[model samples]
Target: ERPEEKLEKPCAAVAPKEEALKPKDMDRSTSDDDDEEADGYQQKGVSIDDLSDDWVEAQMKDVTVAVIGNVDSGKSTLVGVLTKGGLDDGRGLARAKVFNFSHEAANGRTSSIAQEIMGFSQSGEQVLIDRMGTSTANSRNQTWQQVVSQSERLVTFSDLCGHEKYLKTTIFGLVGQCPDYTMIIVNANAGFQRMSREHLGIALALRIPFFIVITKIDIAPQNVFDENLAQLHKIVKSNAVKRQPLVVTSEDHLEQAATGIYGKQVCPMFCISNVTGEGLPLLRSFLQRLPSRLQDSGLFKPPSSPAEFHIDSIYVVPGVGLVVGGVVRSGRICPGQHLLLGPDKVSQFKPVMVKTIQYKRVTVEMAESGQHCSFALRSLVKRETLKKSMFRKGMVMLGPELQPKAIWSFKAEARWTVGFDFSSQSILNCALVSAHFASICPAAVCGASRNVDVPVQLCRSHGDQD
Candidate 1:
């Protein structure tokens, strides 16, 4: 072919707007050069599949594990201990391949307490998902929904406020909404407190599998440990928990303890020290084993990150905007995502933008379940509106829904492990799903609170159409 015909055909064939091109454009053509370079790269022994695993991991989803327990019961510490090896800087999850934190502490310690925890997960990626324990707050409230959208698996672990003041509320909120495998941490020296019994009762009612970790074993007197174990046994037996509890006396003895406690029973105990790093390895091994057990029973459901946002608190950020606080209940939340604002049935949840994330009380880029931190939103939402949007107590903030009229109340199915009865009509101060209550429904009985199915409700109603 003629040289002119060849040149014209190459450019004209590819360019739909051939008439718009001039001879100047033809002489300066770089398209062929670009194609050659691209072809060379493709010919190099590397395929897209050969890219670094880290790059692939960034695009994949991740699993979520929620950490839950009463306040001061070592929930955060336990998380720190469990993930000590994964963090980029610190001793815990910070060293992991998927390390992400809301904020860094003064000692250069990364704060794992907020929505930032979600950053640890990498779907099908060889990264460990580490999470922290914290109450739901405004900033991280959108996490749950994010998790459901981005993850294939989720493990929600709740940490309840352990103070006697919030025990009932915390326990009630955790009742049927968390993980099937629960790790209940108790202060060994304190023995079995009344709240522990209450917590156990809720766990039992849900038929969730669980193991107990007796914290502060390093400081507990030998007799105290024994007494705690005895008390725990009595509580379990009295409650008739379907699964017997496993007890761990010391880290060194975890494997032996695990072997001994493998039967179907009530709460079992494991001795651990969050400060000393004792029993962590065994604990890790046990955790890794749980997924297998779930699979063996043909009941294996890879974790599902449900849409749940637990708001912690609401505050104003310096320059960003209105900020809410709390730990994510189920899924993950991202910086630019919008979330619903109100009640379950009627209230409409307005979509709001997530501006920033603050974890462990410090600001960061992203967040997820298990961390306790604050997050910023584009606009300020009404506090009451925010509260009504949340579903559970630990749920700090939540996506909005229809106007809330009757609170979403469910029947409490529990086995009474203590002397209390559900028959008595005394004012039963309780908190479920984070909303508080002091008066008992005239229908409730006393000590029979076990296996007691009580109708619970949310207070707010949906907004009326203008």
Candidate 2:
């Protein structure tokens, strides 16, 4: 049980004459008596209902942008380029591992102290190396949040996946949860395949800020270029992508293609060979120019305040406590600042403690949106419990009380990737939610309460007969 209870001072603190009219605070009395679930005590103690929506929003944090794409599409390699330096020099890749900040003792100006903390030789670049994670799927988000907690200034980077299949499942976890950004990559060597079309559709549907990164162009054949381009045009045209495929074959040859392709799209195309030393400078220049492109799209703007934050991943840090990782999203978060865990499944909670904060590789007083970070909780909370309680899925984590609308049924427009009969008990996985259940959404029009001719949406890839 919590030891000390803070109460507001009396005229301002004292109960008004109207208190006599209140329903004897019976719920409070009972809840206080029960030590196990003290929700009532927690509620009666703090009232933010008196606060205005503007004030509440003023406290809201910025959302984070997670860059994702198909495996080996150079997601990590590209991120390495943007953060460290042009990959051509090889310094970027090496320095990215020990990127940090330094304090200018003479002028009190703090620059990237990477050299000081990791004791690596200093370069002229202002970038750092990010420790993504050991676990490909579970720990990617944690690495991002750690970056947020340790940096003095806000930072943003991609959450590149290790596998191709995981992209489809992980994409939605980032959708609609935060006001952030995304990047998509494609391989010039493979051209635009059928599976790439599926991935493209998902990105288009979300209306995310994504660019087509054509990697491994050094080996691309010029003879089949027209055929590949035509195929890509057909696929993109059918999907209503509204933009033509950007081809980056030669820095000189693809110059016109690169410049014109981004007509209305912000994410540009680049011909980059992670192996060879060609077109690296152009790619670097393009990246340095991207923030401006985003700005023109009205997607990149500096925050007005420091209350913004985004939930990237939730995990239990052994010994230290529950670790929540994410970007500041918008505003600043400091040690000791109270954060509302919000209405939980069984109860509502007020301000909770911000025990610690880390960005990149060092601790900071506070952090802002676009920065990656993680921190420990003063009290304990289960990672799974927090996920369920908060309705979070991968990148999108919400607090308790904002319960997922309990759907007794949902009309799943599932594509049977593998041919199967509907009578066979369809059980495709809900990859994004990471949960699976029998395909048993009830048919509302049925009078006998029997599962009948349900409206089942089928995918062309999978065989499902009506």
Candidate No. with top TM-score: 2
**Model 1 spans with C-alpha error above 4 angstroms:** 1-159, 172-181, 219-224, 247-266, 274-278, 292-312, 323-340, 343-466
Judge candidate 1 at residue 326 and give its lDDT: 56
Clash number for candidate 1: 132
Go through the candidates in order and give each one's C-alpha lDDT.
Answer: 0.43, 0.40
Error of 2 at 462 (Å): 23
Q: How close is candidate 1 to the true structure, as a TM-score?
A: 0.46
TM-score of each: 0.46, 0.51
For residues 274-296, could you state the per-residue lDDT of candidate 2 as single tens digits?
65746666654443333322223
Name the lDDT of candidate 2: 0.40
Question: lDDT tens string, model 1, 1-466?
Answer: 1122111101001112323323233224324443354355345423433343233224323322334454446555565445433312224332222123333322233223222232223332212323322323432334444433444433344434455564543543343223345567788788766666666555554455567777777788998789878877766665355445555444565554444334444345667776566766566555533341232222222113333455534565455546666545434555543454332233223344465665444444445444345666542332322332333222223332211122233344332333333232323434222222211111222222322455433222111110
* Model 1 Cα shift for residue 83 (angstroms): 4.8
